[model samples]
Target: MGGGIQWQQNPALCNIMQEPWEEPDIPDVEAPTPRRALTCLSDEDSQKIYDSVPRTEDVFNLHRGDLELHEKLGAGNFGSVMKGVFRRGGQLIPVAVKTLKQDELPNAESELMKEARLMANLQHRNIVRMIGVCRSDMIMLVLELAPLGPLNKYLKRACGRELTMNKVIEIMFQVAEGMAYLESKNFVHRDLAARNVLLVNEQFAKISDFGMSKALGLGNEYYKAESAGKWPLKWYAPECIYYFKFDSKSDVWSYGVTLWEATSYGAKPYRGLKGCQILELIENNRRLERPDQCPPGVFDIMLRCWRHDKNDRPSFRDIVELLRKFRSKS
Candidate 1:
């Protein structure tokens, strides 16, 4: 206590000790905002997302009242094709309307929409053009009318009237050209039978019914069906019959069968054989023989298309070239 009293008596030492310490002030800084979490999609989820979006290609959406339904042209498992008039831009245009049967709507809508979308994108002289689509209480695809109707029916009628060989060849040549276009676009028309070919006039043929066409670009040379249905066993290739695999090569094989139908004047392929029998025949390395009056060169082309090994089958381009040469020779 006596020593501490000595420091209080010293003025300079007391002033230093009694001074209070001062601290510097700091400005506040804001914290950064947190980011939201991201989600990874599975393949199936990605496909569903893709399917929900509309294609960039122009597709007309129409109202139900715009179309006036007329006589039915044909009927199929999914729907009916009828001759109709579409009121467009103050003018009535004749069109073929494909209407979904109400009872099948729940199960068939996706397929119908897919077909409509595909047809809308395709624009070729030898491919049917979709005009517009009406998605009201039911789905209706308005398409350009092919006045002469399907090739199979036309062939039958022409046969009865004794049509010329050159005329028949001309029709098939157009089909080959259409197929070549499809090949160039990487589209595989799984159903390439005569019934699916439509005629704009008596001489011109267009490939239609793209419900089974598959666009290839995803490292797949073929499409394997996920489920079974009423497949055209007569027009299918050996591989298609056995493995359910379809590709441009399979369509070529079907084209050969369609040629058979044409040259034979719409005669049934494998006329007396059952579907199972036809499969067995093809499995045993047998193919449809030449039609009674088919030109040897034309039949040769058919043989090339019906090759047991799909790799051995000629491309549609080759088929078109050969057909042109054949036509020149004729």
Candidate 2:
């Protein structure tokens, strides 16, 4: 009557309806636990991650107390290089201690370590050597002392009266040799200039300041910088200025400017010209004129280095060979 199914009032139907429905048994199984995603790591966790990687053997750590800093040799915005004595193995050896200012330490430690690591791997008479590193209260790079100081300042102090054509050629040859070694190691000295080169004496020159240097990866011919800043525009090649590309060829271009500096007795390249004017000059295929003291043959080398086409530039190896012949003739 109510539109529902009715059971028959029979014995079998009534017995079946009177009985309750039974549920089938199901096996109980546990659900898998969810993994927590790590959005940030704690200091301890970060240290643990790096602890798995092996340390580089090139870094030789030294005790900070062992170094006695004396006179400040030079100072810059980030740090200073001071004359120091390093006591090791019962020997007191004179060294240059490079330290970052307290105010700049937060942002400059990585760069200082990078410079130390690069210098440690390099072993050449014409390349500055890293004695060791100190990471105690502050980061310090102990380096072999170049008593004569920067080549640019040394040249300016000499002022042409002390340096002869032969001496200048010899200095250039030594720098070329250092650059050749760097090239063989696949290292590019992005800041190759007279100011970056240091001298142990008038006859011996070593390339220093690897903060801007880069080691090219295997099979890579060039490195691309991520950002533009206060770069040495006058010493840079066209490709470097435009595309931020750097390679051995760019170093050659800087070397040409450095040669000009040496021949001109530390005269600034593109003097009095602003960065934009220098860029315009380069875009128009114009270059610095030859210095009065620079020989025609040496100036020819500079021209070859400043070729508009990077591929047309000579390799450090070729320049070294050419300089060798020139030195012999001089």
Candidate 3:
């Protein structure tokens, strides 16, 4: 089982002008409410837990004991991720605890709150499971433990000839399938970088974080007004940079960047280049090139997605079909 995480490091809010997806306007989707099953760790009293530290005058940390907090799995700006176990009904369940310092981000609470809502509603095989959240003001997203980490990291260790084309396609196919599912639901995972994608086992890839996932067509009134904030520049689509908007198409664009990263063995989608540089390049209609190892088919798909015009990008559905065909060749 996974355990406690050491401290690490941080969301952009939905642009008010952006709209959410149009649902059938049902009264509600009644699933069993999480509150009834939730175990709240008050801001106080949780400090007794070994890995737990004082967060505030009242709040203590929430984590599986350090002894159970497995080896240092990974580290990031927010904190270190550790494997842990939780005993429930006489069984020990594995969990990944993403521990972050209370001050990791200026608005960690709001970002975490937004992520909680997004992940709570998402249910897809390609997406990682959010087991629960622990907080004392400091936050820890209790997520399903992906035994294999991210494919991007795996690619780095693949020694340039690590993965077979078939295996690579299999992983990308999983990502496309997940994207297809999200598009069908009318949600866009604005951030679909390699770091955000994880693999549970060798062949199983899962999109874990929903910190960037949001609706479409709901609040365009505010977010649409031209002054929206910027996104992570490296992974953003050209249109997203210009229009300050996001949609499934924009998601396709982000995925294209992800495909590029995967193909390049987790290389920076565009290294040494800053946002302004990318904007200038896009304004001039310049785009990224494929790596030597990239499959021609995959490279073409990425190109289509990186098109300057939003409408020119392939749909996630289209990409899925193409990926499946590519996969079949193997």
Model 1, residue 216: displacement in angstroms?
1.7
Tens digit of per-residue lDDT, candidate 2, span 140-163 = 888876666777776767777767
Kindly list the per-residue Cα lDDT of model 3 for residues 146-171, writing each as its tens digit. Answer: 65576776666663564776777788
Per-model TM against the reference: 0.79, 0.80, 0.73
Q: Rate the local accuracy (lDDT) of all candidates.
A: 0.72, 0.74, 0.63
**Which ranges of candidate 3 are over 4 A from the true structure?**
1-68, 75-79, 160-162, 217-230
Q: After best superposition, candidate 2 residue 240: deviation in angstroms?
A: 1.2
Off by over 4 Å in 1: 1-59, 160-162, 328-330
- For each of the candidates, the C-alpha root-mean-square deviation to the true structure, in angstroms, is 31.3, 28.3, 14.4
Residues 102-167, model 1: lDDT tens digits = 685576888788888777777666777777688887788888766667777667666737446666
Question: Which should have the higher TM-score, number 1 or number 3?
Answer: 1
Question: What lDDT score is found at residue 107 in candidate 2?
Answer: 63
Residue pair clashes in candidate 1 = none
